[model samples]
Target chain A: MNLFSIFGLGGNSHGVRKTESSGKEEHFTDTYILALVHKLRTPLNAARWALDSVIHGDDTGKEAQREILNEGYNKIISAINTVNEILKAAEMDSKDGVDLKKEKLNLCDIVDDILKTLGYLIKRNEIKLEYGDKCNPTIIFGDREMLDLSLTNLFDNAFRYSPKGNVFVALTREGGMAKLVIKDDGIGIDKEDMSHLYEKFHRGKNAKVVDPNENGVGLYATKKIIEMHGGKIEVDSELNKGTTVEVDLPID
Target chain B: MADFTNKRILLVEDDNFLSELLSKKLMESKANVMRAADGEEAITMVKANPKFDLILLDLMLPKVGGFEVMEAINADPKIAGTPIIILSNLGQKNDVEKGVSLGAKKFLVKAILSLDEIVDAVAEIIK
Candidate 1:
């Protein structure tokens, strides 16, 4: 009946679910659930404070009140997006795999849309984004929504990790494949953390030190989505130096 | 209601909406408010103007972090004595202890406190 029961975190005997029989896996599940709660609280807190200001503050005019309301609305939308991502990741983890609606899509358009969504944070963090494309309208055959989610995950990491640094995103063609490169001169991964980069709920030590609220599900879901599309993902990183991620997909 | 006429306060928070709301509230109390969007910027501003009446710091930041910023300030004799009130989402016992040990006069969790309460805390501190 409670929220934790819905996630099988409650103490109810029937709520208990079986895992891979590894203590590490169970630990990961617990950590992931906690992180999800923390992540959800962030946007909700913002929305709450916005509403609080509108209700209590007296000096604000109608214009300012409207702006605060809009901010609260956006924060609620952000919380919904986080929940949707959790659902998408869970669906992808299912044995049947995620259902994808295949279509002809342009990688450039997808990249542009994600960038537009992140433009505010990019500017606030003082990150300079350099987007280059050797092949215009690099087309690929895939599910637009799934690819959008995957690429957005990658792009989000690139921008989020890089503060006051440059993010260079390049797109090119390599024979029968389309290559997308996202490089950031931000806090990079350590050697030990590199091996488990794609593991569910595994966050790099340095990454956690920088942003502690990260849930560590983005890369795991991203890899799954990419693999389902018959694509490949590669990452190269050096601690404090930077990170570069290369994703290759079959060209249309 | 507390008045903070000409009292200078530096608010170190990254969230645009939250920062704007807090800043507006502090300004309504007549406190002169300076804002920092990241830990690095917070440190820079603190060093540049060490005469601030109080500081409101957020732990999770972009380039640097809140605790590190406090450390940097504590290292410098000129800014070491500046009063700081940590306003963060991290409210674990260890986090609060660390903030207190780092010379934070008060540790306030953002989620639990209302704007009026935060302003009141600030006013009480600097009064």
Candidate 2:
């Protein structure tokens, strides 16, 4: 099962609904451009203001100055990453898909690396994570970097949306497929937004309320990557309750 | 040069980093800064304390938007008199016109203006 089948997107998964009239398409294009502008502008604004404060401020200690400079650097890095994500998405949207370096990978190692990278966020948000005991060393044939990016997006969403909440992750092999499940007791999706979950630049209303800074590109890119790996991803969510995302990949 | 001694200002911004930087800059100008991270809190604070010398508002807020917060403030005669300068990244023509029509004293795009310039704008309006 592909992303189109899972999300009911029906051939136009890139957010342009070909069935709509020309006027609606134009509106969609305008809205998309506006959203993109807002996304790119935010980090730039933050970085500029941080540097300006450092330059124009008076009686600031060295420690505080260093902290502000670090923040500015991080924002610039974030902006660069956003640009890279946009470029990757554009590449995937083209007729020629993204070029991936395929290799044999252990899913467990990828999960561990991602979790280690997210250690700071977990500590800061006070999230309780449950994993490893139920996880088996599942092997898969795919691009390690692409799979890493996709899984990181999912795990990041679970952590970002569910601060101070509980997350349960499990991976096991079932027949010819390796199944991975991530469940978070975070703000779940509204029923109205379920159908549009995988659409490009589409953010749920509740998600916007929780984290307005999100550019809504994570899931879109994640779905495309998963599809390229010949994997199936499914999500089950209820408003205010929690979310459960299951990904199934063919075993090597 | 921008002296806003004892002047009270309300800052309505959702981004934590930008809010902290702006608040510090405003405080450096000798202004008392009060912050509301979302539009709902901004409206509530404005209604409760309507004597602010100026308000710095961001448009794309969480619970409610900046424009709606301004509308709510305008609905109340006491708070409506307070000056508002919009601090937002959205600088489209329609957005500017809407902010102006909603009684914002100045519409400053965050990405375009420096922190000092924003504080200067606040001081200019309040003075």
Candidate 3:
């Protein structure tokens, strides 16, 4: 017999109902996010352990060594892509979120460091890599983790989509901008797909044909990483030909 | 030299993916590997089977962490002083220090140590 009865026991004041609905939605979203994280991480964590053992020599080079190496590396790459997707999704929802500590480091050295993690994958795929650097050994200010991840995502995409072609990585500097170019000759993207290419969860038409389980987060994350580093990402592709991605980051 | 061929190892980790991959790797090394999905299982397995020679423990585990497993291993009279190495993705400076203090002989980050390195570390520690 209170204000509730007087208000017909249903309608609420100005903000209460909206806030409650938003809170419930947020709760469900968080739970879904946590579950996604677990699902994405399981295979990757396992692959890392396997790689650790294989590289550490705990497991001898037996008959299954090469096979395990191949499978583990692929799974790890897939897991990494999944995690990146989750991060990108989260970052999209939160406007001011996840501040990063930027540092000055040589791009060549960063690329070299990422190469180690990717050695097994490159070997398994048999993709010939042609790499060169025209940029000076100058330092740039940016988040090292994001830089590494950006490079990884680029290289992983090249490897994943182009299993039979040569993948190329070239670095150069022009007008105070450090440019990184990655090109792969495999199943290229269509002009229509190019518009939404960097959109989260938007796998290109060719991507679906090349790999059914493609989550379409690599390029999106790559774009985000570039933008976060005060940069821009561009792409050039033609179906049944190749795809070239160019990212330019300012040297601060 | 002690015949370490076929010696059992207690591997504790919370990451299910890494656990399965590592178990397969250890099995390939001919070291009859026993895997625990978490710290609780690790302790239970170690207590139930006292024949394990080395313990490869991951630092981050659900329910019980690597330090707790290390303490449990140290407290048990049956398996005291057994070699334990901390393998983890949590390779921060403080995490390494804590693992060392908890009785792990060595700590290696996953990114730094490849699968081959892990296998090598196990062989060296057990041997």
Candidate 4:
């Protein structure tokens, strides 16, 4: 899906150009609508980031502060759960239901956003995650919502499988592309497991043993979204050593 | 050396929640903050005041949009050079690039940005 067309950009994405058709006004409305969708989702993630930081023991000095933070943490979970339920219900109506409104975004910022949202989960699992560098930059053109879901599921998989070891994430800008490598020293996937790992509802033989609640569908979802953005996911693993899933996306 | 303690900033926004949050954060950084709730007021403030070090703007507003405000302010030669940072939830790629071409120093998406991150960006911009 060329979002430049949807937003009436006439093909050029990095710079502005007038639309060939007489629908300039219509394009403006569509741009505003796309922006409106983003605005609707801003606070949900922002609140989660702020609350997760506090709940993950940024400060536990005062009783009231702890109480309020805990309440906020729980509330964000309920809100997220409700939103997920709604999205899942929507998904049932259409296989590819989630709207993919493409846009150019910083790869690092998206990763950091998801990490903040999962701050509490990471803290609970005792996973040491790293990805930001002041000097390095990684920017990509893709749908923020779809990419958010893809990266969330990817990080979720990495965190759940690896309980003791660090789950390191790094964004490498090289060869005119950005590579997000999520490597974990968890129960590594068997070679056979890699065969159907990206198939819907297919999980490794040992995945259930580590986390019974594993949906077995997250990787497939992540792969689909990544593919939609003209990216590829490759998994390298040893049965006992670790697993690394590298997502390479073209940079704009 | 851009010390925010003595620098004035114009924060143009309509959302009270975000306005208060960002305003409070910028103030804590010791920046003297002025505010405009709409693009019309922002234009006036940008034109009337020449001492502002930076202008933080939001797109959606009650009276006018941020782009118009940008155009109105940038049209004036005296304040045209003042860097304007777009702190918005308008996360579309086109929106960001458009803002940049219109003379935005940086386009920071609010949804994926923490207040601390934004404050850091402001500090960097001031420097």
Instruction: Give Cα-based local distance difference scores for all models.
Output: 0.83, 0.85, 0.69, 0.70
Better of 2 and 4 by TM-score: 2
Over the stretch A34-97, how does candidate 4's per-residue lDDT look in tens digits?
5335534554544644464454423545875555455545646645654563353235224345
lDDT at A60, model 2: 88
Local accuracy of candidate 1 as per-residue lDDT tens digits, A1-252: 333333433332322334555675466456567678767877788888898998988858999889899989998988888888877766765546678899999988888889899897798778998886443888899998888888988988888788899999999889989999999999999999888787655678877766766664668778878888899999999998899999999998
lDDT of 2 by residue, A162-228 (tens): 8899999999888899998999999999998988888877888888886776774668889889889
Q: Residue A33 of candidate 4: its Cα lDDT?
A: 44
What is the clash count of model 1? 0
| TM-score of chain A considered alone, across all candidate predictions | 0.87, 0.86, 0.69, 0.64
Which candidate number maximizes TM-score?
Answer: 2
Candidate 4: tens digits of C-alpha lDDT, residues B8-86: 9999876444565567667766889999877778888888886488899987654567888888777888888788899
- Looking at candidate 4 chain B, the ten consecutive residues that score lowest on lDDT are B15-24
Question: Every model's DockQ, to 2 decimals?
Answer: 0.41, 0.78, 0.11, 0.08
The number of the candidate with the highest DockQ is: 2
What's the lDDT for residue A1 in model 1?
Answer: 35
What's the true lDDT of residue B67 in model 4?
Answer: 86
lDDT for each residue of candidate 3 in A1-252, tens digit (9 for 90 to 100): 332222121233211132257567455444334434444544565576555556654445676567667767777777776666565435533536447679888987887777677876687668888986444585689888777877787877787777767988888888999888889897888888877776544567666544432344446567777787788988898987988989888876
lDDT of 4 at B35: 92
Q: lDDT: which candidate is best? A: 2
The C-alpha stretches of model 1 lying farther than 4 A from their native spots are: A1-34, A125-139, A162-175, A184-188, A203-216, A238-242, B47-51, B70-83, B101-105
What's the true lDDT of residue B52 in model 1?
A: 88
What is the C-alpha lDDT profile of model 2 across B1-127, one tens digit per residue? Answer: 7888989999999988899999999888888999999999999998888479999999999879899999999999887768999999888999999999999999999998898788778877988
